[model samples]
Target: MAAKRLREAEESGEPGRRAGGGLLPFGLVDVDGPSMVPTLYHGDRVVVRYGARVRPGAVLLVRHPMRQDLLVVKRATELRSKGWWLLSDNQFLGNDSRDFGPVPPELVLGRVLARVRPSVSWLAPAGRLERLLCGWPLGRVPGLAARFGLSRRLSPLR
Candidate 1:
C-alpha cells in the first residue's frame, strides 16, 4: 500500500509517502568520516535543501574542490571573494578548506535541514552511552528521553 501510494505520488509529480515518511526534497546523503562526528554519525541520514544560500555555521553538501564530481559535507566557514570557505566541525578529524581552500559557490549542493538518529534502548545496560550519543547539540533531547525512559537532563555541554 505504501509503495503504491509512492508510485501514485511519483506519477502525479507530487511528494511520495512510504512507511509513514514523505518524499524528501534533497534526498538522503549518507554521512561518512568523523568530520561531522559527535553529531552526525558515519551512517546517519540527513535531509537537505538543494541550491539554498550557503549560510555560515550551517552544514552543507558540496562538490569536492579538487574533484568536481565528489560530494562532501562540511560546515560553511566564510564566503570569500573566490567562493565559500568550507571547514569541518571536528578539528582533529576533518580535512576541509584548510587543505583544499575555498569551494566554488556553485558546487554546493545543499544545506542540511535535519537528521534522525537510530533508535537505542535506554532500558538496556548501555543507557549512559545512549545519552552521550543522542546528546549532541542538534536538539534531539525530548525524543531521546522519551525513547530511553530518561528524564530531561541538563544540557550536555553545560
Candidate 2:
C-alpha cells in the first residue's frame, strides 16, 4: 500500500501527503530493529520530516532498495555514484548499504527529527549527552575533534 502510494505520489509530483488523505509535513515511524542502537532502538517511535534536506550523518527512513515494501532506518554515510551510501549504526546487526548497496534519493521517505518514544531506560543518558553535545559551545567540539581525527575513532558509524 505504501509503495503504491509512494509511486503514485512520485508520478504525480506530490509526495508529501499522508496515505489516510491529508497533507502532513511529517510522519511517524516505529523503529523495529537494533540497527540504529545508541541513537534509536527497537520500539522507538520517531518523527520524520518529509522533503527535508538529507546530509551525511543524518538518520533517515527509507524504503529498502531490494524490497520496496520494507522500510528501514539508517544513517546517510556518503553520496555515492549509484545513490546514497547508507549505514547502520550497529554494524554488528544491520543489513544496510554493505548488503544491498546505495539507495536512490527517491526511496528516501523522510529525515528523522527525534525519537518520540524510547524502548529502553539505560540508553537515556547517552541520548541526553548527544543532545547536549549537539548544542551550545560543546556543539563545536565534534567538528574540532573530527579535524584532529579523534571523532573517527569514537564514532560508531565509522
Candidate 3:
C-alpha cells in the first residue's frame, strides 16, 4: 500500500507525501542525492515522523534554508542557538551546515524513523560506531583498496 502511495505521489510530481491532514503523523520522502551515500542512496524511501523530537546525531528531513522548495536529509550533528548544525554522512558530498549555517528549528520537518525502499533499515540515532561505519570502506567495490594494499578509513581525520 505504501508503494502504491509512492507511485501515485510520483505520478502527481510531488517530492513526497504528508499523511492525510493530521490523520497520520508520518510522511514519506525519497532520498534524492549522494550527500548521504553508503548509509542512504538515491531512490531510497524513508519514513519520517513529523514534528518528532529532535536530537543530536539523528537523521532529519529538513527544508533547505535558502531554497525552500528543496528537502534534504542530514544528520543533526549539533544544536546551535539558531537550530541544528546538519552534516552529511558522506562529508565529501552535499550541501550542509558548512554551506548554509545553522537551520532554524521550524525548517526541520521530522526525524527519519526508517528506510523502506530498496531495503528496510531502522534509522536509530547514529552513534560514534555508526558514524565510523559511514567512513569505513565496506561492502563496496570502490571502497576496496585491495589493489593498493593499504585500505584505510576514507577520512584520515576521524
How well is each residue in 1-158 modelled by candidate 3, as lDDT tens digits? 01223334435654444531234677677777788766678888888787888866677877789987567888787687888888777768658888888899998877887888898877753454444444546425463332221113222121
Among residues 3 or more apart in sequence or in different chains, the pairs in candidate 3 whose N, CA or C atoms overlap within 3 Å are none
- Best model per lDDT: 3
lDDT head-to-head 2 vs 3, winner: 3
Model 1 lDDT per residue over 1-158, tens place: 00122223334544454211344444555566677654466766665566666555556777787876456777776688888887665667546887887788877767765664453322221434544745775236456533432223211110
lDDT of each structure? 0.56, 0.63, 0.66
Q: Candidate 3, 127: how far from true, in Å? A: 11
Q: Report the poorest 10 consecutive residues by lDDT, candidate 2.
A: 145-154
- Output the worst ten-in-a-row residue range by lDDT, candidate 1: 149-158
| Candidate 1 global TM-score | 0.59
Per-model TM values vs. the true structure:
0.59, 0.67, 0.67
